[model samples]
Target: MKLIKWLRNILNYRKFNCRRRALFSLKCCLVCKKPTKRGCNCLNGSIDKGTASLGPCLAIIAVLLILIVSFQYIIQIHPHLVRETSLSTAINVTGVFLWLFVSVLFNHQSCVWISPGYAPKCTDGYSSKYQNVPDEYFKYDPELKNDETVRYCKQCQTEKPWRAHHCRVCNRCILRMDHHCPWIWNCVGFRNQRYFYMFLFYLWVGTFFFIYFGYNRLFELYKVSSCILTFLPTIFCKLEENKIVVMNDNSLSWFNGRRYNDENQWFMFCYYACCGVNAVMLTFLMWNSFLLVNNQTTLESFQNLNAEMRKTRKNKKLRHFKYLYDLGSAQLNIQQVFGSKYYLALLPICYAPIGNGLLFPLRDQVHQIVFADTTNEPPNTKHLKVVTV
Candidate 1:
């Protein structure tokens, strides 16, 4: 009985800790001094600080349900060839399954790296010791006294680069911090951004493929229904009555009309069906491509626009596409978008965060070489240059 009471007490304590941690982590908006709420415009004077309203969630659920039902219907209605030819049908079906598998795998592996504390000491020549000084150097100009001391990260105790921001969630200072991604469960920092981008690209492609296959199946089902209707007893009865009235080689006339009319109807049905499906798939694919080209996730794009509009005070206008033209010229260019040093170290893909897998390893090697002398020397004006690339 005593042991049971002790176990119950321990469980209650754990539950209290969990609630306390959660409340502590709930961030307050810097502008409002209130707990930050998602999908809310507290910054714009809307004070409904509850969780996300059911409207958007319901809409998303409706779309997913519709897709699921439509896919099931198509599969059941057309167990055979959706494409006109057997080979084309087989290829379409195979492509759909393969793309689905790839999409699921990519989504599962998405993650970002974060440094919880101070960065490791620079072994490589890429980071200059002098660069550790704060931006006060630039702000005060050369005439001002150089009072800015190099600040080492309290956690990692290593010198951080300019513009590096500490990610509270990641518990580390990320170089050129963009944002944290919950899907990957990591900070979208210097590394893994490429994989994230590629993952988005592949997902868009796979969705297009699935839609195409679904469309063809829908078309085939429609054609089959029309064909059955055209060759029905009602049509045959009308033809028989006309033949008897004409009474001059009616059999041959009836046979020729049925054969030619049925063939033409089926051909037209198949052609139109293909056209409709292709158009819908093409439109959706273009939208996904547009998102990728801008290097913004759908969620980020929406949030950034919301923030921008709030600042401008022109909330009436919904000009989301205005930012597209500024894509390549933005501070986060294609090179920085893909060429993060950390990503090169972790992921196998060489597309972005360029260079071999040895980048991080080489960084370590260089750090060891440079810091080998442990003797403490008085701070001086000497500059140490480390070539990273």
Candidate 2:
């Protein structure tokens, strides 16, 4: 390849500029034949598969369709939802559309641009020092707990903070990472976690808002569509001839499908789909809240859970579970993620975390136990790790 490039350069005999390159190689040949390639590079393959079980393409499609179809369907069925003047219906529909717009903007930004806190370049020195520690040191040894600082990551070629962990999809260590949320196409980390949770909150609210009033209309729509007692199947009769289908430019009526479009069935489908997605997002939001309130991250929870299980296997004794990061109270734990002010948790406003992402407020007793045995010098204490007990 180098020789080909060199010979081509010499034969061209022109200055190393864009215009010369475009004219030379083709200008020499009487016949200009070009073979253009399309689609993804064969060697590079696709990163979407590795990012999550549900690929990026599918996730993007799902997000867009829900945003559009749900709102359109909601407008069509607004009368059934809000029993008031047409002006009130317009306002309600406008609210749903505006909420969805915000969700899409932040969700797209979260997935494509946010950085998940990569380990810094200077951490290589810490990594070098960490390499000298014995392998058994990584194990949960109760006696050597306080000395287990400076975890070395082979992929990032640097040292990781106490709660930091490697994400194969992001291909780096993230500081205070919650999870690799594929839907957003980004890892939820220190910076964009606020956006991610906000997106979830809005999505839940928008969908549930539609469901709250539209539920009765949806049930009636479903009831009219099916009739086992009817002598013939739906396909056997001319749907138009049945005259049961109705459409109105002004009012809500039963089983009204448009001339070519089955409006009733389509509306039902959209409502049910939105309801299901809202349910999933609601569950995810609650789980995220639980993690935030307990002062635990998803990755940390996994490690702690596995460690507990392993200990149980050896001892085979029944024991109650405990949280190492728990601040001994739910309110303090919630403040750790949201802010010192309690109300910040309820709003989506941007607030800088109290800790600068490096140091954190550990439980008072645990903090003392972890650092008690160490001396107060950089050379002596920099390698000390936080012991989670």
Candidate 3:
């Protein structure tokens, strides 16, 4: 009976529905199994599953659609536009569009492929460095009770340092976690945070490029369709019936039997798509820019907001709370995620933060500041240690 029960436990399967079909799974990474406890690369692969889930498959489809539409526009429509416009203007717009497209693709790949820095394993809730250290070593740390500087994650079975958070989707503690992005199908955290930001920036700009160039074409299509419906109702009816009707008027000669040409219809679809995508990207880009400038993650922003609300309730006059990791300089704050070289910060290459995600440099007053007790009266500084961790 004991042997049978152990075998049943080992063979246990969970049922989940995918595309209206319920499937049972065991240790397959493509299903519900936890990521292997090995290298970061394997962890990323297991989490993303390449094209296993709907989000990743959708993302792949979107990218391919964009590529196809853009190629069609460039080949079939851009030449006429170039002839109408000056050579310099066409060259410049094409260059900018190509750059934006390339940047978006590279950054998107980086965000999807990179691991969001996992918290290293620890022995008995303490890192290797602190495993044998005396209890008095952590006495000066003010973050937690009993002067413990590290937090243990039961899910990962590891010690998490400052800013680390456990992701339910990834099922592991990600160091400096921002949030899990469904579009990328990965966590935006310390390692891939910069890539994620660049991806948003490039995608936003690329959509804007499409919106700008396609605006005139979209307007022409709309005007001709409206004119056909208004002045030539018979022709419009023919178009609705899928019959080709050629307009005899010199001004309306551009209109064929179809309400709009196939290329024009595609351009219109892409234009509206860009408009919607741009709106979403704008909101995300602006929010992320604010977080980057202030040295906070999405999680930290919510945490700080809650802290402020609690403080406001305690003291009606206190409205603003200082974040511990701001570093006080916007340039320095931006440098924390991207590399120190300011010139290369805008580039969409591998310029991730150089530090192990386990530790972070604290603000000068982190030791002196207390979230619960924020009276104007300065706390005693003699015994406080300003440790960079």
lDDT of 1 by residue, 1-389 (tens): 42354355445544444433444344343444665564132322221111112223333443353344334433432343443558676657666555554443443354322221233345242445434443332221111113434434566555554334455444566653455544444555445555555555544454445445544443332333223355432222221112223344766877776754554344334334434544554564465345445544443355445755334322223233333212243233343345544334233343434322111111233233323434532222122212222
Backbone N/Cα/C clashes per model: 17, 3, 1
Ranking by TM-score: 3, 2, 1
Best by TM-score: 3
Which model, 1 or 3, shows the larger TM-score?
3
Question: What is the C-alpha local distance difference test score of each model?
Answer: 0.40, 0.55, 0.63
Task: For candidate 3, give the lDDT of residue 205.
Answer: 85
Which candidate achieves the best lDDT against the true structure?
3
What lDDT does candidate 3 reach at residue 225?
32
Of the candidates numbered 1 and 2, which has the greater lDDT value? 2
Model 2 TM-score? 0.63
Cα lDDT, model 1, residue 56? 31
Report per-prediction Cα RMSD to one decimal. Answer: 15.7, 13.2, 10.8
Model 1 Cα displacement at 219 (Å)? Answer: 8.6
lDDT of 2 by residue, 28-106 (tens): 3324354222222211113323344343545667567666666554555565545544767657765766666566555
